[model samples]
Target: MENRIQLSFTVDKSLLLREAISQYGISKKALTSIKFEGGQIIVNGEEKTVRHILEKGDIVTIVFPKEKKSEGLIAEEMCFPILFEDEHLLVISKKSGMSTIPSREHPNGTLANGIAGYLEKNSSVSTVHIVTRLDKDTSGIVCIAKHRHAHHLMSEMQKAGSIFRTYEAIVHGSVEQDSFLIDAPIGRKDTSIIERRIDPEGKQAKTSVEVIKRFTVNGENLTHVRLKLFTGRTHQIRVHMMSVGHPLIGDDLYGGSLAIMPRQALHAKQLKLVHPFTKQALTIEDEYPMDIAAVLEKATIDK
Candidate 1:
């Protein structure tokens, strides 16, 4: 069934087209298609560009086309190990190979879906909110807030650098320096795709790494390194490590070889942030993933 939302507020005349589409929750493609079909989106009793500005008492009418629900979209329930839970927030350790949210290919078995199911099953908890995200193949501690207000507060804290995050990674080469910093800019390699890369004109990205251990594996030097991200960007650690000539082991996308593991050898080892409700500092740590442990063990034996 198609649904229509009527707007009663006047929009600023200077708003951009993309911003309008985002506010309406309509796809840019869909909006363009509607205009191409003619007479679909009637603004103030006439069709207009997505970039058209508005004034006081300007009526906006949007017709949403019916979308068929995919039969493949299956929602499932799974048990998520709760590391900490309180009135305002919950923290959990997410396993590698598990997605943080539902997607077209993975309609279920995601951390978000599982958490939704868990909250439904437990009546004591109310208002589920995700404050931050972790990559599917990157195992780590994640924080979720229980209310919108708390979510905003925690998100602000993260953006302000008050929240600290640390990760452990096994890379392909031995880091010659005891500790170093990678300060590079990252931007989309292609605007059409979501892939990101180092761009001098891109946003600022910084990471500090310290070598914890180093040994030989299959005649190649490997190092266990700890990374602290001063700025969070997509694939920041993986890309920054690669930029420094020591891509993470098993990270094929970033120049790692298949001889190592199957995914990036990175794990979120510690998280520190202030609790939203109590305003008290909270710090949590997680053990290294088994695959990384196994790699370390191999390096130890070879040494």
Candidate 2:
């Protein structure tokens, strides 16, 4: 499949094609790819160079180079609940127990492979670009970009703190505070490849916790909380909650109990961001999954 994007813009003023491209925020790496790789810059239906001079109202069209699909990502048939979709991006609700991407242990049955299959079935580019990801056992919303350009724009937005994510989780004990912030640095633990820990030498990480409800389940104190991320660190929520002496239920990696659930009781419930191409604000949310709902059903809210 031709995994590329074609964008056309009408020049409002006379200028060099390179200047126009710069104003459009086309990165140097993209331009280099278009030049050395397989892409075309057309001016009024004629191929032109970046040095070409343009007149007002001249149509400048750029065909991005085709993207190469990730190696070893075999397309596999699977279905997910699509929340929002457009030409540039899409949001989908993923079920628990599914990994976001393929790995050595779980290669074929992954969200990426399923997305590749979906794209192929729809006659779309099969190259997948996942922008937001969740843990294998943490079910929730995932955002994907259709092309590299969109991915680049989204990365900028994330770095600028324009992208916001909210999660719902059930922890082991009742949280006394209505709202609080966990400002800590996170880094890889020297012991394990998959584990992360709070370290003074690591990068800054912040998470905001707001108590949604206090409850009891099976004579055990349980708290349902809403969490917002201020920084994107590996296992930020799990590590931070554990540091606060309230590990999430069923999160075995962070000293949590596995009595009520077999996986982390965390779900990405909401996302807020501005559309990279349309410049419009977007808010997407997903309902709680059955397992989480079932756990809540057995609980009695504390007065």
Candidate 3:
């Protein structure tokens, strides 16, 4: 069933469009676009322009459109480690090898399918919205919104830099510096699938890396590192690490050839954001996956 939402609020005499933008944290362009689309924004029960002036006691109504569901959305049964859940959102520890959403060949066996099953079994949530997505091979913390409003607000927060994400990785070489920032541009390769390269014409990307431990595994140097990303781009960490000549272990696409591990040794270790409903700060962390942990343990043998 498609869900609907109606919002009612009284505008103050001194309220201006800019004031509303500041309060709502929505771009003027977005607001204007919504108004132009028709029936989205109403002032005193009538369709209004973005420049419409408001008087005291002017009742505003916002009617949001329902998100269209994709056809043939396959549902699958899979388990998600629930880190936290509430009326507004959910935090889960997504495992490696699970795609976040249904794509061409992987209609099932995805995190979205598992989440749908969970919501169906619980029966409390009417809709699920994914605010962030991790790579299929990268495991770690992910956030899901239970409602459209929550999704909108949380996504806005992320765009405004109110959300923070941290990751952990095991790179193939020893990192000499204690900490450093990699500010490189990334773009698609001229001819490649599942590959990205550092290019001058690419989008801006930055990653802060700090070495957590340095050791040897099977006579090969390995460095465990923590990464804090200032900008999120496709394959940002892997590309940046490779650009620095320290590609992550088991990362086949971006240059590391260590096959001891099954998947790329990257994990979304931490996430922080404010609650869309309660406005309280929420922080969550996920532990390292077993495969990566085992590799690290073997590296710690002091060989």
Candidate 4:
């Protein structure tokens, strides 16, 4: 419920809090939020402001107050895997087959439903607010805010590029290049209500991809790719990969053959962001599931 993080540094040279924060790679946004949030910056057992100068061997401790959870959401009893959880945010490790929130058909059995069940016991959280979403078949990290203020803060951070999201996938073919950028416009498909594709008039979308590994399986070529999302869009990864002629292995809707897995072979692997209230830099990673791990195992090294 309560968390404390201390970033201790030995001053090789004298410095102020600003210089030390820069040297230590601390979040400046976090330092500024101390006025609003219930946190303290302690230096050598004494509380001090950021303007205080530091000498050698100063131990700094940051105290993060436990956040107040809200109420009103009806909780569902599903045991969704939690990657990281605190008062401010909950990072969920979503399964490949689960939806983040409810649709007309999937009104229940969703991540939101599970979160509601979780908050029911805590008695502090109000409505469920999902900060990030994953496609039903794409498994990985999804962030949820405990309250509305946290939601607004995270959304602004995402627009400013402070909140970073990354994913990994097994695509249909070997990539000729080790790394490349897919800078394309994405728009909704005319035929499908949920499907998206490359369109000249659509909003700008960019995905930076790096090949982690490449191999052949049953004479079929596949590449393991890590992609960084610059802009979040519906079916961005699935659509972009298809445009490049290498859709995800099991993404049938996006020109991919469904032979290995039943769902798209994409994982939300990493998420990085600054804390909305505490100002800490946060990183969450989901463990590779056995389904994807099995694919990695069968892949023969492609030289």
Candidate 5:
């Protein structure tokens, strides 16, 4: 269960070991790690340098360096459902009110700590390489990489816009449009350290929103909406929804009423991506959180 990858390759034609490695999209940084770190490159059962020439049909193997756990992360036992798992990746369901990683304010009882405990129990890699993270108050699926190589590949995929995430939210008011795009820029608020605002000088942000249902609770209008983020900005959905006068329910920071739901009524519902190593399509979805569903069940559908 060591966080090491042993990749085997067959040389179809004559070439240097370095060139063959390049064909597999191995970066120069990985090569450097191999050379300096405790990794190795072997040819036909013998260790060899990258410059070594390889004959046709020769077997090549690359043993990636063993990974180490991040400092200051302590293992803690916490129950979480594993949505999907493999040798390289793990998809976990995160409940609301849990921080993704340990911080100064909350150093333990985090999702990372829980995962570390899980890995320790299994004697797997101790490092918790979270590929996707959610806010402390948000509930949903998070993808974790088992090794650094997998993390690197997932990072590249994210940059290429191949990693897609979908969210579900209950907003304050009934949306006028059934489907539309929220095209705006988001920037840090001038006064607050943790707040964000829609600013013209901010980075571009886009969110596609589609209404799923409209209902009334206690004579208050509400809309359940499905949202897709085209950009990863801090507090983006909260800020964008506020800008359009439809702040999410229970999102007090964004001027949402906390009368119905306690914490921002938002959930990271789904994720879509292609497995970096297996090159297979993956679509993972989390069921609607019970807290949100409970609120919706008390409402009457809007006519």
Candidate 6:
């Protein structure tokens, strides 16, 4: 059953309706959308406009419209490792090789397709609102907002840098420094449309890597790396790591050796964000996937 939403607030001081709405962190776009859907903001049982002034003891109420699920998205009954779910959002542990969204190459069998099936099974009435995304070969936590309001709030948090994400990877060589920052600007490679490279006149990109532990595979040193991204660029982590002479294991696109692993060993291990409606903080995490773990086990030497 969909939860009934009726936000009520009592005026403690005199203020314009628009002022109160802004102070309450309500989106102006939401307000316009509500109006289009016949929902209204009422003050003391009377419908009011944003210009309306409020007095002390005035009761204000906001009504939300019905949730509408997305249409035309292929709903495939595929399995996913769901970590946390609520009425507002879902946290899923995506597996490697599964694309996050649908595209021409991946029209079906995507995370979105699986999620569409789940929503249909539960009889939900909302569209898929992907708050964060990962590359097709990367596996880890993905946040899907169940409604537009939650999506908007979470996006605001991301822009503010309040939604923090951390990744774990197995890089080719043992890093020389314990921790370092890759403050290089990234842009589309001149030769390829999909590839990215560091350029002097590119978008600013920053990534910080920490050396967690060092191990070796058949006498060759490999680094267990933890990464924090300050910017979201196309193939940022992969490109940045490659620029440092330590491309992720199994990632051959950027000159990584794929002798043992088939796919990139990068994993989205941690996600921290505040709940949109509840205002509660949530930190979601998942262990390394089987494929990555299998490659890690190939390490014959540990240092």
lDDT of 4 by residue, 1-303 (tens): 243323455566668967776555445565555546776767888888878898878877655444444343335888878888877688989888888878676677888889887876667534687999998889989999875546666877888888899999999988989999999999998998989999999999999999999888888888999999999989999999999999999999998888988789999999998776567888889989889988888775323
Candidate 6, position 58, lDDT: 94
The model with the greater TM-score, 2 or 6, is: 2
Task: Compare the candidates by lDDT and give the number of the best one.
Answer: 2
lDDT of 2 by residue, 1-303 (tens): 164688789999999999998877788998998999888899999999999999999999899888887888999899899999988898999999998999887788999999999877877753899999999999999999988888888998899999999999999998999999999999999999999999999999999999998998878898999999999898999999999999999999999999999999999999999897788999999999999999988885423
TM-score to true structure, per model:
0.73, 0.94, 0.81, 0.76, 0.94, 0.91
Better of 3 and 4 by TM-score: 3
Q: Which of the two, 1 or 5, has more lDDT?
A: 5
Off by over 4 Å in 2: 1-3, 300-303
The whole-model lDDT of each prediction reads: 0.75, 0.92, 0.79, 0.81, 0.90, 0.85
Please report the TM-score between candidate 1 and the true structure.
0.73
What global local distance difference test value does model 3 have? Answer: 0.79
Clashes of each: 0, 0, 0, 11, 0, 1
Estimate the TM-score for candidate 4. 0.76
lDDT of 5 at 279: 86
The TM-score obtained by model 3 is 0.81
Tell how far residue 245 is off in model 3, in angstroms. 0.7
User: How does model 2 fare in lDDT?
Assistant: 0.92
- What is the Cα-based lDDT of residue 278 in candidate 3? 65
Q: Report the Cα lDDT for candidate 5.
A: 0.90
For model 6, which pairs clash? 69-126
Write model 5 residue lDDT over 89-123, tens digit each, in one string.
99999999999999888899999999999988888
Candidate 2's TM-score reads 0.94
